[model samples]
Target: MFKKRSLWISILVVTLIIACSTSSSSVPKLRDKHHQPFSSESIWNMPIGADAQYSGAGLGQAKRFSPEINYYIVTQETDPQVPWYFPQNWGVGRCELGGRQLGKIHVRADLIVPDATENKTPNNAAAFLAPDGETLIQLNPLTRCEKGGPVFGHPTPREENIYGMGITGGQGGSGLSSIGGTIRLGELLPSAPPIPHVLKLLVYAHQYLYREPPGYRWPAVRSDAYAYKDDSPLRYGGSNPKLVMGALLAIPPEMREDDLGLQTLPGKKLFHALQDYGGYIVDDTAWDNYAIALESGAETEFELTYGYSFGKNSGPFYEDINQLFRALSIVDNNTPETLGGGGTPRQPLAPPIGN
Candidate 1:
């Protein structure tokens, strides 16, 4: 009888051990490899590419078909010189309406001057003048300025398409540029927008341009129109107008991948802007960097299908832009315990496969 009892006890012990092992194994262990939580300071200070490795000044030109129009990224210093009639300033600074400070604005110039200048004989010029006689410049200022604080001139009713603010996390719709959230600029910074995704794209293109060892050259002018332009003023109109504008920063290829939660087609389109246009802006500063970062954050929601669906690894992306600033200290330690803590407990295991 004792021997029988011993056998039964052995069986029970084995079963208990197995149960414990199985339970432990079933527990989910969340792992995030892309962006291990780091203190905000560390991430913010994280070296963005090699430092002054990429630094310069002056307006970078973009080619255009129109002779009167000119496209370029003007640095902050040079921005003031741009004609008042110009649509907008592409670099940093507060936008003023009628001499009052409106909200902060980012100007992306599409048409610098219109083709109508070609037909002008100096006699019909009076017809083109506004009631005030200011020559109507075709340049359209796609301004992204603040609302409510200091009511700037109402954006033209048709200019309301706020699309392409870059990685605004699904807040905007159908070509609208108004980002849903506001990100403060300056030392005491608020959360960043989803603009960095665009920056990432620009960075990627910059990398591509100088990929080879020094001395290797890629075609400086790819478009045929600009390549064959003659000195004649009329032929100047045929110049590749596209060269006049490039992104202030390009998006990195890796950023477009599913990991960052921006795999959708729209996300891809935004990413293209980043890749193509990154760093085209003349001025490079902390404020611009921060703006880019915040813009990227705002765009995240948009990329995720109005925040309903997200890429599998997008949690970190969200955290990087949204919570990183607040959780800076935690990120330094590079552990969940240091950051926001680990994920919640997993659900209890279901009954065996068949029950």
Candidate 2:
């Protein structure tokens, strides 16, 4: 009788375990209204790849090294009378909008992914205008600078008086004042590869051939890929259809993936940018490479008081401004792969026949 009782208990326990496992796996992963899966990959600041090509020397240059993802282009115009916001619920992280009215591109809901959710805001509308007066581009949620979003909505200067003002101190979105987020290369700073500086001024100097010093460069490039073109005019650089949403960029091989620390004010602001939302590859063209848009109001500001410079009057000198670009690349946001596989394996469709 004791042996029989033990046998029954064991069977009962096994049955319970199997039932629990089945119940958990049976729960479907959340999908947005469009039947699109709520992808963890869309999450902001999630590390996607380890290294990519940044050389602008060649034309029709497809990114030689990067993860495969879908890219989309949506046409939209801004309404000067009404304010717009981006739909936050939908996981759509990348896209381009052209045909701006009133110097701004107002994006509507239908333009967003069908799966996107109605986020913290009602319809999730947002306007994007490249400082170079191109069109609107939204990559990752964290990399954007909405009017009243979590980070700076307008151009904000770093207050030297404040001690702990991380990356949140910058104006927030795409602008000369806006600084790009930093990445960590191995334990040391030198081991990392070169990153882009999406700040407006640096891009302006590069685009206009302002005859500046070595501004921003991808560490692996053999030559200064951003050399000014003596022949090209001040045309819009942020115009490219190849750059799409959900693309994963390769990080520098030597990057210290574990050391994304906030060591400086700009670094802190960048940290906040990624912490809040993620960065996405918005536009990629010969004219402009990696135009990461920040909040707004990148007009003009002083560096001694703010740590960044803008406008003609904002004097840190052209050379000094270039230094800031170099400084921006030296970030160590030891970011991690937030969306990669690390979950329960799915059960086989059928159970094996036992002897």
Q: Candidate 2: global Cα-lDDT?
A: 0.27
Poorest stretch of ten by lDDT in candidate 2: 159-168
1-355 per-residue lDDT for model 2 (tens digits): 9999999999999999999999999976442211111113322212323222221221121111111112122243442223323323323331222212122233333332323333321111122333333232333232233332221012223321111111222221121111222221120122222222112211222332214433222211111233334465532233222212222222222333234432344433333323222243222222332223322222121233354442222232332222222222211222232231112211111121121
Candidate 1: stretches off by over 4 Å:
1-248, 251-267, 276-279, 282-289, 292-355
Residue 327 lDDT in candidate 1 = 15
TM-score: model 2 vs. ground truth: 0.26
Candidate 1 structure quality by residue, lDDT tens digits, 49-166: 2111111111122111010111122223222222232222223322444433423332233312212223231100000112222112111222224431221122212221111111
Query: How many residue pairs clash in model 2?
Result: 49
Which consecutive 10 residues in model 1 have the weakest lDDT in total? Answer: 121-130
Give the top-scoring candidate (lDDT): 2
